[model samples]
Target: MTYLRGLARSAQLLGLAVLVFCAFLVTVLMLAAGGMVFGLLWVRPLTAYCRALFGRWLGRDLSVSYRPEPGPPQPDEEGFYRHDSQLYHGPRFPAYFQRVQWAADDPATHRDMAWQLWFPLVVLLVVPIGLPVAPLAVRAVAAWSAWMWRPRPGAKERRRRTDAVLLAWAQCAALLLSAAVQVALLAVTLACFLLGFGLGIVFLIPTGITHYRWLANLRRQVSGWGGGERIERPYQPMVRPQLRGDGLYRVRNSLYKTETWADFNARWVWVWHDPATWRDLLWLGADPFVTGVLAGVPVVAAVYGAFGLVLPWIWTQAFGADWDTWYGAVAGNRLAGLVAGVLLVAVGFWLPPKVLPPVSRWSALLLRPTAKEQLRRRVERLTQTRADAVDAQAAEVRRIERDLHDGAQARLISVGLTLGAIERLMDTDPEAARRLVAQARETSQTALSELRDLVRGILPPVLSERGLPDAVRALALDTSAEVTVHGRLAGRLAAPVESAAYFAVSELLANAVRHGGAEHVTVDIRHRDALLRITVTDDGEGGADPSRGTGLRGIERRLGTFDGTLALHSPAGGPTVATLELPCALSSPKTSTS
Candidate 1:
């Protein structure tokens, strides 16, 4: 019985080996012919077959470790699917290419390919030893397959190290390229200045100064990529020429008939007078020399060390060639030259990650915006926010007026007409008059109820009476979901701040129940560091997009009046959290809670 089982297992192994060999040949041919997508089609079934053979014959489990397939492409607002920056009319091509890239990039795919090539050889070498050694050979083949195909431990760490080495070399290359661009731009700057000031050809001055700004901006952007603080642009805002009542466009004190020369003069003066213009010129002249040294050391060391020293040492010792280089000979000693070469190569690899961050910091000293520019930007922001607030207020007033004219006011007028009718009918028909009075009373009550609802919509009664903390608690009670409120405020907030916060919370709670299908929710309100913070969390189907919903945008506009912000984190599956923050001082130090 034992011999029969061994013979059966040996036959199975022999068949599998032949099948894998044919598959390997086909895969290689398809790959060589530039049909990689078709080639990868062979790897999946081949891996599955190997895994099944190991499990069934040897009773050892082999797991398939291929990465999950990419999901279907999602379309944008215009109903077009986007891959990278290009928009596709349909999802078919994008999805296919995405899968191709996914498979090609997967480490398991490569491992499986390697196994297909090796497994056939293993079977040929070990299976020819006859039936006595058949079971042993099967076990050996299974072990080899398991070792090659299983997920490698510490793979992620290895990948990270590989990435760091690549990034360091890339940064070295980028720095050298930037240095070359700086040298070219600096020459253009001197020529422009010479032409503008020396020969009175002033148009070239602004042209050159404005054009080279792109390079300065690129350096500023590159600083942040090296894991350093971001540098902000320091130039003043450009103001266009405005036509005066006299039908002339004024740039400064000078006025012109047509807008063309006025616009040109305005732009020229704008670029020439700004302090950042000079600072940019100064940075352009200095960056190549200062940052150039930091970037050059690693590259020069790596190139020189590899070709100049290491290869020369190899030539002298291994090939019996003369060592005649000026730098790598190391006093006519080959071993010393080899040691020096290895150390220099190590230095080249180690220096980029260490020095790139400091290079960014040094660039920031000249590239960051100055104090005057900062103040100017702040004023511009405030002016814009104020305008947004005024527009929001006007819209709110119009909404209230429209609601009153349509709802409560119309109901009250009908009630008054019914009362007059009842008075005229009192003597003629007592039963009809009594019915009219009853109808008038019911209509009046309905009108009053509508008035209360309208007021509540503007400002909830609970909010004005008890402040933000208690008001939020009342809100949670009215909601359909099970809601729990945590934390308390030390005192009442300013009226405008409290009102803005109350409505913002109301909007989030309504959205959670209506759209999210949430079963439970939590509201946490606290005052810390002179800021009123409220967080509303719900466990539901999230995927709340502010751009798609008007409720979230209205909440944003309302909060913007008080300089408050709403931050939402709602992923696809469940659990959405909305945080509202408003800066205000607490007044009357009495604890408020529900």
Candidate 2:
């Protein structure tokens, strides 16, 4: 079933990839040739935009697998919000309609899509743009689709409805007269430019600078409250309360709550509207066209020419060297050259025509600060999700502990008392006594298993019995990866610290085998001074965020509780290396057979 499901998923991805390729082709034809209908604009490859907006919703579901709870996320305090001039937080949209609010209701940061902002300017500057209405109509469709007819209400549905009506009127008027607005703005910029750089500076510099200053002030106002401080008067529980006014936290509290975001956005959006400060996303598609040709033309040339030749093989390898002797000699020389040449041709020659331009365009579209800010916000969401998951795990540990004491441990105590009573009666009644002894034996066995499992849950005794070295050796033997243990332990560590370090390495190795698909794993334990370090390196798929799974995160929490540390460095392609360090008392400076 897993194999069949895998094949099906692969086919689905392949189908989507083909569709995306076709859409890009369609986008090219419609934009270049004035032939396609306006509704066809969804073919412009809107994946990136859609991905950002929906990533959090997807991530929220994703977190549950990492022990995520169906509850609140963290940073649930004031500093996370925005503050006003007087440090009051702006109003925040409620959770249910947050995405909708972001789209239609976020007064501070909604800029129409880039092409929507650009084509009118193009029509004004040049007349050659065919089907100018295509771009405008596309924007109208997108805007409508985003907020139209959806069952849910946004943060402020009434405001959005009014705004939509107003925008509809503005858009129609703008469509009729955008050429005029473009020309007017051009005239103003030119009139200013006709004067010295001073006129341009006067028009542009302050526009961006003022907004930057205001945002800086807002960030400072909110963050300053993070340090614990109070207004002078202190309070006792049932007595008078403490009151000191730093004004920072009071403002942060207001911002962290409902009011903070509205105030912050009011300032932040001012930065976007600042003519000098605002990023012109129209540049996203534009600069790529120019720079892409400059960069891509050369690559195109290489793909066709020297890059082809450098693979160091010829025609037979391209076709193949016959099935049995695929690696056999060609022209009395090994076909390594021929095989490499074919791969280069496939990667370079066939792929570039399809790959380069859109990648450039997508990259260009993502160049602005707001896009970056959105990505930053996405990461923050995932991080907070992880934090909430960790909290849940901590709660689960407590529950498990309570369960053992109330259930298994209580049962064991009763069995022990009953066994004692049975022994007292054993001599009086022989057959009944035999049955009681058998019952006691079974209960004892069960009690022993329960105790062992509980202790394993707490800390595996392998950690102390053989220290880090033997514990890791045992873990390596347990995994499918070609795991090798190297180096020596200086000696014993603080028992708790040793246990935490050993478990951390054990979990990391387990992750490498179970999830990483690692074929080669190296575990190196070294002690220097009072620090005991274990490094687990694997040749596998890299991107294992410690916050993404319970294995890594559980290790992290355990280490934290033990005054130990864990770190990972994994990049794409392969090769993940995780390092753990714990302070321990060494029996000697160093010891090794080597």
Candidate 3:
């Protein structure tokens, strides 16, 4: 079976080589029929189509390829047909489509405008290509040509472009060298064909393969190292099948399995397998592509050739002869190589992607996720808050009960006892009974004051009657901190939100008065774009750490329950500002019963 399989593969590859030769003839006939420019015009679209098709193939979600033909029963494999959350949970094709549409490199919009683009290419194709230096076309010409030298953001893409040019030059150079050898063989006898054939097989084939592998390896070296990734071997002889226990049930797998199809066809082929000669023939079909780009592409090639090639030659001729004798130039040759190497390195590396790393790092420095993620992680924060509110109400109820039982009830009992005693004395002293009633009235007044204080602690009366601004003003008036309620907060918030806001403000005012030791302070509230922002700033000896006490901690807890945040910016010697940001989603409930 192994012998038959290897034979079959060899036959397939040889047949593929013959097919490529035939295809090259067909491509030549097609180009001749259409004329070179017309044929050339199609290459960009074909290249773009190939790129997009391969990109889509690559960008497909990674699929697991299960093994053992019909497959083995394993615990992990049992879940293969089961839904993976990453594949199943989120939105479907439309979501990915929307993401791809919003992607920086998506082709959807370009597809919509395709009609507008190809018409110009079609018009240019109908005529002999021109490289006229018209002033109007100068910017377009410069931009398009300069694109080749521009740094692609991904190092892989940059290497692809460079290697493509190198591969073409290598192939063309190989063909010329091989053809020269063939010509030399022709000068000899027909018997030399057999000898020449042997030489080509022994020498040219291996050397061509080595040239191919070197170009392939060079791309991997630069791209992998530059991108800071693990580099795989660019090419290797296929490893034999691994033997299982008892040297039976041999299993063979490709060293690097393709995670996506595009890698298999393009990136994969480069990294592992060498493609057949059909790919080379198809590449030959692209000569019109090269010729057209050279012709219609202005003095782009000329500019690259002149400054990139000719000007350097001219400079060498001009400057290299500074010394009369060649021996005298040898002493300063190190300086010359140093200058040349510096220029070469600059030319090699300086471009757009290299220019942008500083900006990327700067943006990364300014924004951080630690605090925001900390808030997001509190799971049952809302439940804890509502429980606290209930506890506060319960404590208020107990205080009210104690005040009534001790003060009012006791005063009534005393009044009864005194009145009874006075009734006995009523015949003798009616004024004594009146004095007992007056004592009960005084106790009643005290009880009322205590009840009022308890009720206010549960929910302040000022919040229910006057809205946030007025309630805040009342706190400010009572505060020892010379407080200024600065900005106008015109709109009414939902009552619960307003109540939360009111209490937060009230607590701050009380703290400022008692502890902050400030001469002046400012409170400002504003409603903008469905967010209510309240800022309280104080001019104090201000090293106010919010985490030190429950005053700010409780305030933070309240804000977190509502998916809001409080930030404190207080420095040691002066002003302290506390800013609160919250969503204005408060729909008022009839919460007065509690």
Candidate 4:
């Protein structure tokens, strides 16, 4: 039964292997259609499919987050399209040039290309080499053990000796069959390489690109099976103008990235020579070998038992011979052989299923990334986070400038105009002058209100006067929704971080009241690991999308400048939690004012 199950599992893997092969071919063809400069456009979805497959089948997940592709240019509410030139410091180029330029400038694209180049070989080697060993070994072991304790001297002594010799030969045949399968695997590997490289050299890049799309998919499977951490390179490609001074800045920018070099090294050197690769090779060999040992014994026994049962009947029918002569004369009892064969076949079907988990885990162990790669990935993330912080700060500055110019400044100008009117009317008619003075006073008050709001938007006076903890508590008191503030810092946070935190909370509370329909909100704050953690929870309509609204997006941008992260958890029905983390130190007790 175990052996039968093992064979069934093997059958499933064989089917998957076929799919892998076909996917590889399709990927190559897709790449060839173009330079596959847009290959990632298709490749990412395929990668996701493979990620899902690995997670479901092998318990491995390709946990990768890809940046969204830029969509078509959108017009503002006023029906004007703001060109990227306004945002970017570099001189603008044609839209087509920018698209191609950005695509070429991406490090991930190059990584994709590298992946495409090597994937076919990886799939060709890994699927056949890694998948088949266990079941075959199970068959071999089954053959040896099936005759280990047979009915002694049941027939003539001579017949017994002949049966013993035939059984030995059957056992040898099973072992030889296992060896043949492995040899065949090697032969196929060599043939694939020879055929692929020899015939497809001219089309290598395209072929590789396509193959890589699938190969990455295969790796995802391996990764899931391993249940180990995945190392992702964390660099966003610089999309600065690709043509500076009429030179190819796109190529230059791509070359300049550390991510590009990491990818290049991985493709050309580390992929081949890395210890992780060797470990994968070891898994490729070891998994089948172990599983084969567990399952082979029963499978081999069944094949021989089935053969023994069927051969006699066929021979007797063909020759019109007696049952005893045709069936019993050659080996052992005909009925017994038939029964054994049927039972063995059942075992073969059952045994293979049992080995799947262990085999998957073994595969995973070999496939996980090494420590060095993990550290490198961490550094990459830190670098990207730092860059985001700088960009967010610059954007915040611009936003503040724009607000001051358009809102408070405009209001002050209106106030000045009203004052001038009052001055002109003063002597012409005293009663009219009084009315003008009242209008001017009202205009001045409105201007003052606008200025106060603008100033508060920049940095609330409460945050500076009362310290962060009190400011937040005061914020909760002012909101229409019932709000609670939990946790406290021993000392005050740095002014910038405190201000960022204050606004972030304010925006969230506003959102909860305005859009969330939230009746109650909770703000939980903590100081740990030289970092400030704030969690804002509200009983509200649950769906909160970072991409949908300007308010939340603005909060995110503000927090990002302080190297703060926001993780929003909002389900569709009700309740939302926004967790924000920022690295910072508390001011000393002497300096702290609560």
Candidate 5:
């Protein structure tokens, strides 16, 4: 069974390699035809799919998110707008050229291209090496297991028996099961190849895909048994049937816009070099062949022994004819021959169960992350988080500058003009001068109010005075929607984290009222361990996209500073939920006043 399982896994891996190779060829052809710019329309989606596939293979999520470009800036409180004139109104360039330029400029696109170039090398290295190495490795593991479980000279009888039974059952079960699966896969693959030209293509795609999926599942199962952590891929995008075009249109779209071809190219060039792929290749070569040989040899011997020995003796005795006896008179007994056949069949079934565990263990070794790889991944994550923090802080500073310039500064300038007019009028007309003095006083008061508002916008006084819960409560009260707050958070968070959280919540609520057309909203905040979780849910016409809106992107950037994450779930035609998670420890509780 272990041998069979190994063979099945190998077939799946080989199939994947072929698919990737085909994709690479298509991508190259497209690129040569100058479709690289429009190719990105397909490339981005293709990259996402590859990330998902990698996650499945590795048994973990490998999601990488890209921020959408910011849109034109909107007016501030003082009715003045800021714009990047060059970005929006640069010298005339072709639309296709612009798109191509954008794709070339994107780091994600570059990474994908690099992966495409890297995939072939992995396939060339892993396939040939894995085929021979896998079977030997499985055999070595079986040998090691037997040696390890061998009874010691001073071992108790019961202890020896227990160890023997455990070793026997695990090995046998794994082998039998894996072998059965491999034989089935072999049969299916043959059928697909034979019928592929006619009815085969239709069945081949689905069957081929399912075969690999099961192989991946087995890998995950064995890894878990060996104490390896499982990683899940994030949800891949789903096509809505209702939104789909007609058949003709769909085909045209596939040719013109769908990333299917580009996906093929990316997948071909990037899928083979990973640990999961190597392990899968190992399973393909070892499991099926070992199980077949071990189990097949005995079954063949049983049938031949019965015919050559027992059958001749039986015929000679029954017909009263002289015949040479191969196995003495016992070979003439029909009942004995039947009994031997049954025993041989039973042995065939028994062999696999005894051999499977060791092979599975061999595969498991490949699935586990090496200590070096784990450290490398950790360093990469930390580096990215630090960069995001710096960028977010810079953006915040720019925002503060904009607010002060547009709101408080503009109001102060108006007050200064009014005061100057009053100075010119004071001696010429006493009554008019008195009126001017009162108007100037009013103007100065308005300027002071604007400054206060600007300062409050920067950091609300309520937040400093009472902390997050009270500050959020004030925010809810200020909104038009019927907002409900659920869950309790005690004590104070670090000032920057708290501020980011508060504003993130504020932005969601504002979006709910203004863009979402929501009537009711719910804010749930809870602290668990060293992290704070905030969820804002609203009954609104959903379709909230960060790419289309600067507000959500701003919130994401702000939260990124604290190693935080934001997930938006807003499908069309209904409710939206924005979840925020931040890693931080709370400070001592603010003193409560009655």
Candidate 6:
């Protein structure tokens, strides 16, 4: 019976191979004939069939792990459905496009295409032999199918290492290119200075100084890419030329009727007088030699060791070809050459991870802002945050005023009018007077409720009384998503700090539920080393950008006022984490309800 089953399995495998080949040809032809949508549609069913066959052969259930299809679009307050910021009257087109994008972006779709192309070829090669070899062929094909169809455990780590090596090579190429660019820019700088000082053409000076600023800036950015300290930009903020009341723009003692010349002159003076410009020029002149040696050593050693030494040694030993090239032998000995070549190759691989960090630090020596620049930058930031705080306060006041006018205040006025009516009716009609009194009582209750709600909006009662930990728990209770809070503070934070943190957490929770489509969230709050740290994490489709949303920027400004910082790590398909840190001492422990 076992022998008969093997025979049957062999026949089935051969037949399945032929069938898959035919499907593969059809899919290809459909794709070639301008039917990509149809081709993609054809792939899923084919993958399902193959998965079932493979699973039957392997004796386990195979599963598909495609991303979940997006649900139907919900209409906004204006009764319009939104997809990627584009509003539509109906959901049909948006749904269709979204589905198309979903299919295109899915990794499973590509995996299916790969299986369709590769599986049949493997089966045909293995199963074409006689029955004696058929069982072995079946085993081979099953293993191949499992590897191709299932996710590999080490794939992510391997991919990361591959990416790192590729990035290192790319950085090497960029360094060499930048060295060449530096030499060229040094010539341009000299020409600009010569023209401005020697020939009296002042405009050329700013043009040349500003031109190389981008290269220096790019270096500053990439310096931090791979385990390196980030170098902040050292240049001062440019001041715009201000117009005077006398219908002229002023730059120092000089004034011009039109704004254009004054602006140009200001830029010229700004670039000329700033010490950073000279520093940048000095860096440019020095970088070509310093960075060139740092970047070129590894690449040159690897290339020379592998091609120049190792390959020639192999050729001479294997083929007995007495090639008399100076590069092939080290000091007239092939054995010595091979050992030296292996050592050089080892050095090449080992050097980049060690050297790149030092190179970045070297760049930071000149590129980082000086003490004066740091102080100035701090002052500017404080000024901006103060302005934002003032504006926010003004807006909050307006909101309170509007709510009172529209809600509680209006209700109170109606109650007063009703009471006056009741007094007038008491003597003439007793029944109508009693009804008016009941109406006025209901109106007063509603007005009181509105007043409480408005106050709560200003500062939540839980936050003010219980402190941050309990306040966060109260917040979690209010949100629709499941939230888990961890960690404990020994005591309470300052009132203002607590308020800022509570509101920030509230906003994050709201965003996670409404925008992120998250179902679960975690909030961790702990204080250590005189700093209070809070982290909000959500398992959501995370692509949060501060530039795209005002909520994040508002949180930043609020935190900045207390000398705090907010850091966000949100990848495309991920669990988003937003961390908030504030430097403050905690008071004595508060009595806990928990």
Q: Which has the greatest TM-score?
A: 6
Compute the lDDT for candidate 4. 0.60
lDDT of 5 by residue, 102-215 (tens): 667766666566555554455455545666565443333333322322333445876876676555445444544666776677566557646765674643533432355465
- Write candidate 1's Cα lDDT for 444-495 as tens digits: 8888898898899898888878888788889888999999999887788887
> What are the per-residue Cα lDDT tens digits for candidate 6 across 365-400?
888898899999889888988888898889989999
Worst 10 residues of 2 by lDDT: 231-240
| Pairs in clash, predicted candidate 6 | none
CA lDDT, every model vs. true structure: 0.84, 0.51, 0.49, 0.60, 0.63, 0.84
Candidate 6 TM-score to native: 0.63
* TM-scores for every predicted model: 0.52, 0.34, 0.36, 0.44, 0.43, 0.63
RMSD, every candidate, angstroms: 17.0, 30.8, 31.5, 28.6, 31.8, 15.7
RMSD (Cα, Å) of candidate 2? 30.8
Instruction: State the TM-score for model 1.
Output: 0.52
Off by over 4 Å in 6: 1-162, 165-169, 194-203, 239-249, 255-264, 311-342, 412-449, 526-533, 567-577, 588-594
lDDT of 3 by residue, 1-594 (tens): 244443443343334334434443444565578444333233334334423432333343222121222222223333432223333233443344333334313233233124223323432432223223222232232233223222335688878867754443333333334334433333342333345466653223322323333322332233322223322332333334433545333323333232333223333233224332222222223322432232222223323443544445445667863432232222355345434444543433333233223222321222122343334434445667667667655765888788778876776677677667767866777787678667767766775676677677666777767667777888788787788886555455666677678778777767665677878889998877778888998877677787788888777766665667787888888578888887784233343322
* Deviation in Å, model 4, residue 139 alpha carbon: 56
Weakest ten-residue segment in model 4 by summed lDDT: 142-151
Model 4: how far is 119 from its true place, Å?
Answer: 71
Which runs of model 5 end up more than 4 angstroms from their true locations?
Answer: 1-273, 279-378, 590-594
Better-scoring candidate (lDDT), 4 or 5: 5
Off by over 4 Å in 3: 1-425, 585-594
* TM-score for predicted model 2 compared with the true structure: 0.34
Count: clashes, candidate 3: 1
